[model samples]
Target: MFLKSVFLVYSLLVLRVYAANIMGLSPFKMSVIQPLLSSSKNSQIDCDHHSVKSSKRWDVVDMLKAMAKIDSTVGYEYEVMHWLRDVLEEQGMTVEMQLVEDEHQSVTGLARHNIYAYMGKTRDTSIVVSSHIDTNPEGNIPYHEIGEEIHVRGACDAKGPAAGQIVAFFELWDASIIKEGDVSLLFVIGEEYNGIGMKTAVESLNATWSKAAIFGEPTENKLSKGHKGNFRFDVEAWGKKSHSGYPELGFSAIEFYLRKANTLLNAELPYSPVLGPTTVNIGTIHGGVAANIIPDYVKAEMYIRVADDIEKVKAYVEELFNTEHSQMTIVQYLKPQYLSFDVPGFELIACAYATDIPYFESIDVKKYLYGPGSISVAHTQAEFVTVTDLYDSVIGYKNLITYNL
Candidate 1:
């Protein structure tokens, strides 16, 4: 037992020396020694720590975990915004809130606010790091840890990038590298929906002088050169209601909708060499009151990921819906956006998803989209972002800020 104890002590001494070399700490320092000796008995010491002493640096994982705990789905972003505002204020940054009126106030009964933080008054040449603060409502599930990956609703879709941006901003602030009004962080809401938060911010903030903007979205750590635009509409078919048993007495709205939707699905959509072909999704369909009654009014919401000019696609859709019995209403239309970046050591790729880039087009700033995580799992139940990816994104964002500055 005594020999075993001696061997254990020797191993610990060797590890302590290695940790001191890596962490650049004095091995004999009391702060280091006390923690090392008590670490065996202390539950506070994490097994993976280089030594018993806890690092004072801000942890991206901890911050992400904190942010993930708050439910920030669409219209329900008040709690997360409050938490972010407090954290930014504690970091000595000037924080401001842009109140966004909820269009569904009668249904949700919740107010929405966009949070913006910066060191000083905005400057004309400032660099902006931005990301959405909300996740898809369907995926607001609890976060869980699996190995080095964190599984959560918004872990990859946005919250991960948001946390990374915050950490990068904090690091820049700590290093005194960025002056007041040199760099800013903008966390907007409702990107998962119609981008109302960004639209509100652009008009209200009047930040046209900003030279560059770095948007955070899941790109698996690569930079996005361009992304597809979005166009949404609902096709509603109306017909006379009749008993299901009656064959030719009344037209079936469901049949009419199916024929139109099939025609659209089979039609050759405009294709782009970079963004590929325009895609359509029959997201939701509703019509009949019962199985026994014919559906008098049938409606199907369709979303098109447009790869061509938005107007061209809109015109094509209108042409497709020109039938006398059918009608289409435009829901949302955002033009395809192209981004540019000169950051070294990163591969550039194209994204098929839409972002808030369209809303910021009025500012005339060079925009770049980059972040950790993959888009494949963004809105899925198994959404996740690796710890390494999250940590690396902090450096990525910092590099972007440094380059812009």
Candidate 2:
């Protein structure tokens, strides 16, 4: 008994050293385990030891701060990818980089890559946690702290959720509760402009048998039932240019755009009880060279938040455009995406914004959309996320993964 006790003490000391060195915990924080060794009950000592170790296994705040400081704007995620790769490798995960061709390679002359990390045995029934690594092109925005919030361009949009997902992954890995091939993490690019990265992943990765996939987006920590579809187009008008004073002498392209805009704004669109009514935004309009000159050409960009069948919506838009004289060119269209939420304790909502969900339609997996923060502030200059939300998401993701597994 005496020898057994001594060996157990020595083993615990070794574990403490390993946790301090390998787990990135400060020596001061590692000292919390010293008290557990003095307890008489072996089970109590083990429980206390695990509690201390888990608390210091990964620093959620530091990880989030590091991620927020990096500039991962769309088409420019190379540097951030390197940093993320190193972080995942340090946690003892097997990392894989999949090349993604840049659609703008003709202009930028460069390519990018997506990251995948996993452990344990590979299986078709693995759970996937995914999020985009790119942010809106907000330039070099620094992270700022205000009360309980952290302000940065991508903080609310996706980086916050990404960081939270990483922390949760680390927790599961450290606990050894999940075996290899049970869970995988994916970080993709091009979510802001297009879903090219996700599309590539669905094609390249053998993930068709995945049982469930959690897509991290800013959902204010609620589980989304689904989100609306998207359809975008450009309207162009052409007319003869003339002096503004003699407007009747030349047809005004600007006047044509205004008339069309008025008709679109007042037109009633189809509505759904589950997904809500279709909404439209005439996002941009440009015409005229000068105030004194009648414009020869004008173009307006519009996006529709589609609620139901995208084909029917397209037909409706086509009929509407046919009634007008302007030329309409379709840019992009995506059908509505519905997600699953078997895990309990979340309020369900239908998101109005679109995500990369539609891009993974070919992958035969149960999809889920969730995360921290809010979409309302995602692309705004004042974008921010609560530090509390970031921490809570770590727990939320862990629960989702645990439940699915």
Candidate 3:
């Protein structure tokens, strides 16, 4: 135990000194790295303290575990951003924090930041690797290993991919494979919610930073050829409220909402030969104050996976849900995104989930989606990724970056 603590403390000190010397920052006065080092009791020496001297297969496992332990759900990505900034800076990379505050914060009341890093001071690069630093709103699950599989919230969804990307950058830097402004790493926030972080990045950052981009998501180590788009909307029904004993005097909002919801759900939607049939999910429904009283208002939140054109899907919904006593308000929508798998030797598949891919449409760069773990178990209590898969992705990401370079 003592030896491990000594190693942990020593690694941080060495990194602090190296970062200070490289970035011209003040020498070691306790930074964000200290908190992570002290909190991560099981953290291993993934990289050499002085320099990147090792590229062990399981180096990312400990790091991923530590990152998964941090609760960076949706609006709460500030701490994770700070930790990633410190790590990147310590590795002699230039880091910046882009605040993603806008009108949305009035409701969430929490401001989040995105971490962007690159070699040297220049922002221009030939290749870029990116991933979301935030997970779903589900509370943080304790990190634990069950045989080769590790169970933890955000393990498969993104933190696992994020950790792999970080290590891949380190490996590339250590081997001198990439130089100043050769590549950039972008970790965005709010991908699980509204994709505001990515929008802000695209709007604020230099669009010409890179010619190619590698986006990390849970693709089961496969390179995605395409992924379905999405549209979110809410259905609200209003009715007269009255006592249940005299039900004839009042109309039930819940009953009206159910009827509309059922009709809309039963309607046939668009389909695609490659992306499959358009699907809809009634994610949430809330109404009624008590069983004895008729509910005056009811709302149902719905999400649609767009396998076909986004406009067609919207038209179908708007046409089908037209009614007198109900209102259908569109919340958010993203067109189905397609990408190239031109790089040889990778398995290709289509994903149903939406990512921040579409937001970069204006960049005019070749986009590739690749990562470790399975999306099948991403948001559930059983969310997990195997140590083997996580480590393999580290090498995979390094190779992808090499290809772009």
**Local distance difference test scores for all models:** 0.80, 0.77, 0.79
Q: Which scores greater on TM-score, model 2 or model 3?
A: 3
The candidate 3 region of ten consecutive residues with least summed lDDT is 45-54
1-405, model 3: which lDDT tens digit per residue?
999999998987887776544322344332525222223422332211212221232258756865676678788776667766766676677888887874366356666788888876778788878999899876666666789998988898898898899888888878889888788899999898889889999998763555788999999999998898979898888889999999889999899888767876787777877788888899999999999999989888899999877898888778766567777888778998889788878888889888999998878788999888999989888889998898899988987888878
lDDT of 1 by residue, 123-222 (tens): 3337888999899877556657889999988898798999999999889878999888788888999888788889988888755445789999999999
Per-residue lDDT of model 2, residues 1-405, tens digit only? 999999998888777776554333354555535433222432321222222322344566656665666667888777677668866776667888888875366144556789988874463447888999889875655656899988877887788899889889878877886778788889998888667788888888765446889999999999999999878888888888999999988888878778877777787777777789889899889888999998988888889998887888788777666444478888767888888977898888789988888887877788899999999988778888997998899899998889888
What residue runs in model 2 are displaced by over 4 Å at the alpha carbon? 1-57, 102-106, 120-125, 138-140, 322-325
Global lDDT of model 2: 0.77
TM-score of each: 0.84, 0.81, 0.84
Q: How far in Å is the alpha carbon of 244 misplaced in model 1?
A: 1.9
Better of 2 and 3 by lDDT: 3
